[model samples]
Target: MSTPARRTGRPRSAEADRAILGATRAALVELGWGKLTMGDVAARAGVAKTTLYRRWAGKNELVVDAVAAVFDEHLEAADHGSLRADIEDVVVRFATLLERPETKTALMAVVSEATHDEALGARVRSAIVDRQKRLVLVGRERAQLRGELPPEEDPAAAARNADLIFDVIAGSVVHRLLVSAEPVDREWARSFATVLLHGLAAASSGTGTAPAPEPAREHRQKPAGSV
Candidate 1:
């Protein structure tokens, strides 16, 4: 008789991962971070508690994974013909994600706790913030290829610039959503994009000031005799 093939244990399910993460987000929205538990997520996901524990150590890791998935779910690499358009598109998408009740609550609660938890803080940086910053680098590289942005002569400066831009865009949106309690709608994103793009264009061209407002046109009767 031929030897029987060896069999491995059951494979993990992608559907389970999605369900667990989705349930985690729902739990965060309904229970907040402090009250959320693996049991609750397991019940919500229709899986056993051991299933969740097998995938993540505890609430922090699971929440971070869930939140990161939310961010990744809607993110798209925009190629909107111009950097300004691309930035605006990304801004709108990010704003949409922040507007969701689950995302807003989970992000703030985790960030607040992470301030005192170094490991959690590092996880937040790696899982979510760093991925968000990648969008900026993508837009910048695309703009450079399209001749909209000049190639950087100094790699360090380029990196710093990218970091700064990421902070501005992400920070502003968060502030609007959480601190200011305002909507980051399309109009607001467009306005923000205009200001950001103009500033960038000015910096790239080494023009610090706003062209002196065209010297007010100097329309002093247009020299009545000199027409």
Candidate 2:
């Protein structure tokens, strides 16, 4: 996500930044990602086109930051008192956010496009995915503190465990809500959470273990100038 740039070497305007991102999402609702443009967003935001150019290189970066802003604001994990409750809260919350017309349409469009654009994919992962992963980490720590989970002796293993949990939660919600066109209400959240927390807590207790990942078959060559 590109930071909104300073205007003519002065500090950036938080108000203007908010307006621009707000305008972007609003535009996505009306026009969808294919038809939204920087000029259109600037017009909606009541700002000069140059103001947008100063902050973002183009539409891809702008839309990404716009969507990122929404996720950051709306999708935080609340203290639900238990891992199951937290998972249920997060799943329902994520579903509710994606149910919004602007977020549903815009995020799906950008993610589809990002499949072919590595840099854009990384931006989506960093700006959105990584931010959500932190919430998972926070919730996991809370579970540990409550004695709902044991502390992994290896830090690296703990990190991997968190990553796996995040993938499962995100994948299940996105597939159910978006692809399956199904509801993700409290009942569904509870059932799903029960299943997920079962294997998760079981593994931590040594009653079950996650299967070993298959070894990588190969490494693809990185693109030029790629990180």
Candidate 3:
């Protein structure tokens, strides 16, 4: 009789993977890429170094996986009917995510490391670019569907414009995060969205009156003279 084929797949534990990713994010936030070590992650995760190594080839893989997890949880692609709503959703979400101290620290660590590590830079680009592109595509499609964009407008150009809005939102937050040291909240997000929508609408219409102001609420008069 032929010997039974050996099992090829290793049984992996989801719980262990979560712990490892959590540990890796924590380590990156605290120590950054240059100082982070696998041993440090092991200690923080309460897992043996062998267990981590069994799953990831090295620290780079582990860090990349952790960053991916963060993005998956935080950076959602929203479809809110109109392009304006979609842009608002993205800006709001971006602002909210940047306010998280751990997330900010971890992202900064990845960015700093990307300056010197080509592999890490590629990983970062892969993690962020396509996801961002999807958001831009959604915005462009919505604009076309709503007739907000010109019929002759290039989809790629529309997408690029969406990306520009994202750049402003992200740039403003990063500036405050790095310099002013103020935490971004819903109000700030709203303002950013308002500004971005106005700019996009103005660009599309070739008019400055893009983000039409919200109508003022009128106070009701008490029947003739009675207060």
Q: Please give the clash total of every predicted structure, in order.
A: 0, 0, 0
How many clashes (backbone atoms < 3 Å, residues ≥3 apart in a chain or on different chains) does model 2 have?
A: 0
Candidate 1: which stretches are off by over 4 Å?
1-8, 200-227
lDDT of 3 by residue, 1-227 (tens): 89999877568888889998998888877787778999999999998899889988888778777867776777766767656667667766766777666677777777777888899888877876545566556665556545555433466865677677556666787787666887666565555555665655455553423554432223222223545
lDDT of 2 at 29: 86
Task: List where candidate 3 sits over 4 angstroms from the true fold.
Answer: 1-9, 31-34, 150-166, 200-227
Instruction: Judge candidate 3 at residue 73 and give its lDDT.
Output: 76
Error of 3 at 31 (Å): 4.1
- Candidate 2, residues 47-69, lDDT tens digits: the string is 99999998999989998998899
Which of the two candidates, 2 or 3, achieves a greater TM-score against the reference?
Answer: 2
**Candidate 2 local accuracy as lDDT?**
0.83
lDDT of 3: 0.70
Indicate the TM-score of model 2. 0.83
How displaced is residue 116 in candidate 3, in Å? 1.4
